[model samples]
Target: MKKVVVTGVGIVSPLGIGKQANWDGVTSGRSGIGPISLFEPDEGLITKFAGEIPEFDATHWLSKPEARRYDRFLHVALAAGLEAVEDSGLVIDDSNAQRVATILGVGLGGMPFLEETIGQRIATRKLRRVSPFFIPGLIANMAPGLLSIYTGARGESWTATSACASANHAIGASLRALRSGACDVALTGGAEAVVCHTTIAGFNAMKALSTRNDDPATASRPFDSGRDGFVLGEGAAVLVLETEEHAQARGATVYAEVAGFGATADAHHITAPRPDGDGAVQAMSMALQDGGLAREQVGYINAHGTSTPANDKMETAAIRTLFGDHAERLAVSSTKSMTGHLLGAAAAVEAVFSVMALQQGILPPTINQFASDPECDLDYIPHQARKAEVEVALSNSLGFGGTNAAVAFRSAR
Candidate 1:
């Protein structure tokens, strides 16, 4: 089997744009959640905050006319994908373009775009006023489609829409393809731009969002006793993956090894997690088993602590059940404390953070941990970063419809 390794990473996070900015923000425990700047929230909207990128112009990556053709998700997808290719320094010419795959995960697609075209524009004007780019920009697959077109990767291109686990599934699929010789290289990740009025309204209606409008920065206090719920966020991330042999043959800089991937369905709830955390335990165990790593081998876990009442406790119980005493030793954290919840893009962004942790030998802190919940007790590396020699790291993502996914990363060095 071909060993899967990461060569490059690009991020479009609220922490900042690009890889280094996100690294600095997360490692320093900076919170990006604040009042929504993407659009004016309804006066009576319960949740008024989100992790939105301020002053982002899609024309920076796409031409003016091209930018008008696609939705925000595709815009960020192209930007992040291009940045990853440049960071990897991989030349995708006529010969190797066919050997490169592009798989991007997107959960919401162009909901905002569709809503605007149908609800607002069409309602105010005639159907003829609608732009012709509506369908192409409104589809979820266009994130990968536009990214592939930009990168010239013609191999096995598609998108994953597995709710929040979309990116993990996309990454896992690319690893499988690489191991099976289906592709020599893969550009895979996720993009989400659902911080619009409709998304915020919907999540608020379901009580899945935090209503801490008074204190936006501290709203995403994962595992904290006074936590309310996750804050909606928008971002995109792309990882350049290639076989170990291929990467070495071309002298590419290796970031980390994609040791194992585990994805499972909870089959229990649509939006809530099972209290027993059985599916999460299975996913984490499968990742360890697939990587031939014992529970003690994993030094850090980028937890899916959504700051919700159910998820944090469930994830804590799952870790304890699977790792025994090692769970106590693990530096578990939720970067959602800073970036809010990026929905489908959460796994991809957290995967990059896990790889960064292994490479830097540092664990990013989960800030706003002033208080703790008894059911969610663990070494959360709270409020501050910690210096640790991390060898193996686990990134977990649990999504709606009981979807659970875990990906294990091993230090390249």
Candidate 2:
């Protein structure tokens, strides 16, 4: 099997616009959650806070006319993909460009555009006013389309629209392709730009969002007793992946190896996780086994702690069940506590954090963890970052529809 490794990463998240900025924000325990500014939420919307990118200029990537032609998600993918490619210093010439693939995990696609423009036009009975770019903007696969166009990655261009587990699945798909000798390199990650009124209202209606409007910074308190629900966040993240041989040939700086990937479905609920967390356990177990690593070998876990009551509790139980006593020794944390929930992009960004932890020997913190819940008793590494040598790290993404994904990363060093 080909040894796949992560050579570069780029992000445009609420935490910041670049890789270093995002890492700085998460490790410094900065909360990106704040009152909605993209669009005004409805008066009764309880969850008014979100993690939104404050400043994004498409001119940095696309021209004014080009930016207007594509949707926001497309712009995000292009920007992040370009950054990842540049960071990797992987020259995409005619010889090796065909072996490159583009796969994206998108949770919600073109939602903001649909909510802000098309929906309004149709509601007002101006159906003809819908722009010609509607379909181009709305489809999830278009993310990969833009990425492939930017990176010239013609092979296996697609998107995994698995609700929340989308990005991790994208990463997994890329890993499989490379390990199977299908593709030599891939730009795989996730992007989401749904921090709009309709999304907020929708999550609020489902009671799946935090109502901590008074103190937006502490709204996403995963594993904390005072936590309510996840705060919505918007961003795009991309990782440049290539075979170990390919990277070494190009003299790329390898950060971590994609040692293992496991995916499973709860088959239980649409919006809730299994009560026993068996699915999560299975995913984690398979990932570790596939990675040829023991539970004790995992030094840290970038948890999918969505800050919701059910997800936090179930994830905790699943961790305890999987690793038993070793779970206590792990430095577990949820970057969601700082960046909020990036929905489809959550796993991609968290995966970057996992790789960063292994590369830098510093773990990101789960901020806003003031009070702990008895059920979630573990070393959450709350409120402040910690410096520790990490050998192997697990990044978990459990999305809606009971989709669970666990990725194991081994230190390249």
User: RMSD to native for every prediction?
Assistant: 1.1, 1.0
How well is each residue in 243-313 modelled by candidate 1, as lDDT tens digits?
A: 99999999999999999889888889888888999999999899888878888889999999999988999
In order, what lDDT does every prediction score? 0.90, 0.90
Model 1's alpha-carbon lDDT is: 0.90
Candidate 2 regions with alpha-carbon error over 4 angstroms: none
Cα lDDT tens digits for candidate 2, 151-190? 7777889999888889999999999999989989999999
Clashes of each: 0, 0
Q: Cα lDDT for residue 217, model 2?
A: 90
Candidate 1 clash figure, as a count: 0
Per-model TM against the reference: 0.98, 0.98
